[model samples]
Target: MTIAPAASTSALSFDPADPVALTQALVRCPSVTPEEGGALALLATALAAEGYEVHRPVFSEPDTPNVENLYARIGSEGPVLIIAGHTDVVPVGDAAAWTREPFAGTIENGILYGRGACDMKGGLAAMAAAAIRYRRANPDAPGSIAFLVTGDEEGPAVNGTVKLLEWAHRRGERFDHCILGEPTNPATMSDMIKIGRRGSLTGRLTVQGTQGHVGYPHLADNPIRGMVRLLAALDATPLDTGTAHFDPSNLEVTTLDVGNPATNVIPAQAKAVFNIRFNDVWTPETLAAEIERRLREAAGNTVRYEIGFQPTNAVAFLTEPGPFVAMVADAVAAETGKRPALSTTGGTSDARFIKSYCPVVEYGVVGKTMHQIDESVAVADVLALERITHRLLASYFAAQHNA
Candidate 1:
């Protein structure tokens, strides 16, 4: 797919100091998951205008959609600080239910409305605006400032940050510290900062049995009976109580399928799918083994079953509190007058992949409206986030210079 520039009428002038305007410009692009929708193109134009060497690389997997990503850098020296986020928003379900145009970037009573108003086009705009203002103020900053924006964040994530990071690494690009602008706050903008994320493991369990009449007492085996027992056994045990920096591990059964429509027929097969969000207490390998052991105990020697795990990229990770984390917390407090809590209480994010490269953390606007109808963000909060991000950059660079 061709990456087109934002249409002239919809394309507002690029101003990195005005995050609200930048967000509006971004919201105007209906860049739903896997579709460029002119969002990255618009960002590239804006970054290039700010003297950033911008690169838009389109990555493709065999069956997944081709994704467009942006990697723009300003400077070539030490202590590189990378700010990362995604432009793609989830699909707007039931468009007719929206109070206004989902892509109009409409501002009504100091609120901006759109599909990605909060989950995270607003945050992306905030980071961009802050970085531009910082660089403009201090032209010869000590280190490089780069953006790792991607389009596949809300999708399968195959052709986005993961690949972008690898691509950048191959090109010898390195960063000292990184910030992900995912909507981390639960209520207010200063409520929290995510230091880590729980790992996700999805398992599909299938039990096979002979098909026969339901009324027959000894003619057939009911796989549903075994499946229920197996699911119960999986759910009955707790993975972990709770770690100091992480939450208690939890397993939830997402789906159960028998596919038998007739009430009088015993189904030939039964399947159950469960997803476990675990803490740092267990690795993916150990967790999978524990689950299998439980299933075996539950099945006994009678039921024939097989279990398979879905291929996942998410793994539990933590960015131990250190100088970089303290600097970020100080920045948030300085801007918002509230000391943000260092937490690891959210779902997996791109940070899982980034932690292997460098220290990373997440902070952004409140997440209450993400993926909801009439999704919107307060205009003031967007500006505040920009200020917070600017403060973070300022403090980060100063600390780097002093060191």
Candidate 2:
């Protein structure tokens, strides 16, 4: 069910300096995927009150849902630091399974419980809070602190960062670096910082065959036999020996379906869906061509087959460990007493879009509970991340000023 603005909605207040309160207020909006749920409106008001020039742009792509996005900035100058996030969260499946109301932003003991608590509403709040603090302290701070918040990240991803970045570029907005507040840490708040992400490609492969009764052995051609052979060939060879900062590319066949349940018949068609998490070694075009090569070689003109590749914008990217990387790591180390590892082992994020314009890395809350029932984040970690982000913001401008 889509959340309506005029129904079951009311004005919600927030303190720009308090992230926990911001998280609760934002989560309470129920901004489920593709729904505004007043999250952007609430943020716009808060940011505007803090003297930010806010713009709520509505983007649309044919066939996909039109989504509302937020782009707010305080200072516009050289070396802009774009803070990116999403208000849209995955749906709460089987709401009855949750220990508390998923959108209520309940707190138990020391944990904040809610749907988007850790997945990213909390992370986004922390970023906003930290930026507010920095801006209030340094009203004339050098560089820029802009937000690229979207409501389509958990959906088709068509009307979100991919388009928002283009909109920013069209207006001659240049970004020097980006910090995406996703729930990147797997265990503790300081375990890992995602420096890169593997590219993803999904494909559908179909094999054609003849259908006949069980009594006719010679007339029936079983596509299942061809499917098994082709599947093996696809996964038989290693895509690469692992990139310098990434794991070896891997392909997994997610589903295989023939659509025939009867025992006395041979299915006329067999289709399989597969996805690949590839490294920087291959582009989508090269990878698709290689898969076709393998299929044609294995089929050898005997098995009639078809292949189709889905459009992908998620190409592998890396923010090589440089001055910007060191600054962020220092800020985290200052809070955690340990240096976080610069890792490239994770699924995709909006960073893929941001990287096209500037160097982008990810850091946020402990993601153990994101997208799961009874999702929650520790109060300590949330506050700690805010402090870390605050330090990063301060140090970032200090460096720019000194330079």
Candidate 3:
């Protein structure tokens, strides 16, 4: 099928060995959340050139924005290895403050600068390049290789990977393992490999009260006071000591809102939002019950409050250390000369969604500049990441064939 040129920038020649050009080309597309911006089309065109059967499906919900997602596969059979990432980037805040055009995809002093460069259009480019190169060299490679690219990761994530996976499953797509190309490295390309992610839960607590003159203590019930006390109760004790594979659970109050400007009047209601990054020791149901128990005990009969939990699919997960992990780690060490630490300390990603299907891990470029004004990635690191991915594919397919 013929694909149209990307709307943001003209299509450039794509080379499998050199991912820098592809990275630059992709960054030129201004694909902010829920927008196509020709990013997926560009990728689909490039993958089609490499013999992948590409499918672009636009998913929708009642209130959420419709999202476009891509699923492309190159081979017909064997162990399927899926490389997942997103092309849609977060909104560029205050464009005037940027050192260069946020969508220009400029390379200055050997660094590629643009949104999604590190967080992770660069990674996506590298994965594509690596897959192409591997397919060319090992035309009869034992397993199939696929790309699951989404445009809804940075938004509410309702119509993205979670739904795409289900769609693929209904069509009888079974993956042996998956790799998420999120920006996992905190410092350098070789810093770490994410084996797991902490679970996320957000709660909105609203305390009810009677509005009255501030001077009349007996007539007014101040919900703000009760809100503060209840929050303190939730924060008073540690959720748990650090587990062997995870850190201590943390609850942070993100916002407190009473919205009352007049000092003479007590507000009728106070609301506070808190988010918890919990470990595997607790499930969402248990955690919610525990939190409610604490709030009820702290509130007593005097404080009237209501707690509600936001819907979330982010559950804590771990991919045990096995041949797959060791193989990827070895590939990194071989390419960068640094043994990466297997860590589970980061915010959640789409890996949380893929864990249900198969073993999944995350490793990509350095993320220090992701979502920043002058977001970028070192050109050299992009090439290195491509090489690492290439090596991983080679080893993975070889092991499967031998086994």
Candidate 4:
């Protein structure tokens, strides 16, 4: 990372380490997926002005839109702790239904409302504020703290963290451990800590049948019958009872469609798409093979069917309870006065990609209205998250001093 000149304070209205103010500024930006909307540049400028070396790398793919990501650090030393998050937010459906302006970053009474307030612009801002405070206090901390912010998480996930991590690695940036600032809490800032996430696999099951008049008895083979039978087979048994750290792998049918408009005519084709959130019990290959086995047994060489799975990057992973995890847990417990559950029960996140590089866990604010009409976060929760993050950082670098 090159040392860029400090930006003027004119762009930043609030204190550099104020999480609540920073989150409001971030939420005001309409950074819908794949759009910069000035979120990264705003944060980069703020971080650079605080004496951190910042680098913004824009990535591109054949079909996906270009994306910009930021990597910044204030210290150069051992045992780097990377804080990762995305600035892009999902599109707000029915924007008119929002109580406040979707991009205004409105603060009503005590709650801040905006599109990305909870599902995780707030988390990113909390960590940023905490890191800034830590650097100001310990200018030459023994261990380094780095921020990895991306703009393509809510998009196709291409040209984002996956590529950013690779680019950083190629440039000689190594991470010792990572704390992803995803919204892990269910109702409060200290509700939960996501230690791991399940894998995701989606497949489409299609059955071919001859189109004919519905009045005809034996003229056509109804694919709907075969589709129902195949679906039944897939759901007949559980993939696994439950893993020690993970819940039972679940498969749910998302869509059953024939695209047929006329009720009097039998559709020529029937298809059902389903998704599986699996545990460590199986890999994508194994899961697909198992589905095939079940479908084959039910088909008996009579049903004409084909099953195809979509490409996936999410895979089950866990960071076993250890010194590093304990450090984070201790920080949250001490700050919140509640012992947070070390859970792996939610949908997958970018941690699936980061886990390959280093041990990674996710902890952040409550996300009740994530991607909803009035997405919001409590002002006090953001402040608490900042404090917890600062405590964790202090503990992490103190260990290095002891070493």
Q: TM-scores for all candidates? A: 0.96, 0.96, 0.96, 0.97
CA deviation > 4 Å runs, candidate 4: 1-11
**Residue 376, candidate 4: how far off, in angstroms?**
0.3
lDDT of 4 by residue, 283-304 (tens): 9999999999999999987789
In candidate 2, stretches whose alpha carbon ends up further than 4 angstroms from where it belongs are: 1-14
Q: Model 1, range 1-403, lDDT digits (tens) per residue?
A: 3333332333346565799999999999989999989899888888887788888888888999999998889999988999999999999999999999999999999999999999999999998999989999999889899999999999999989999999899889998899999999998988999999999999999999889998994899899888988888988978889888998999999999999989999999999888999999998999999999999998899889999999888899999999889988998898889999999986888998889888899998889999999999989889999999999998888888888
How many residue pairs clash in each candidate at the backbone level? 0, 0, 0, 0
Candidate with better lDDT, 2 vs 4:
4
Predictions in order: lDDT: 0.90, 0.89, 0.90, 0.90
Q: Write the per-residue lDDT of candidate 2 for residues 183-258, one digit (tens) a residue.
A: 9998997799999999999999999999998799699998988989888889888878887899999999999999
lDDT of 2: 0.89
> What TM-score should be assigned to candidate 4?
0.97
Clashes of 4: 0
Deviation in Å, model 3, residue 252 alpha carbon = 0.3
Best by TM-score: 4
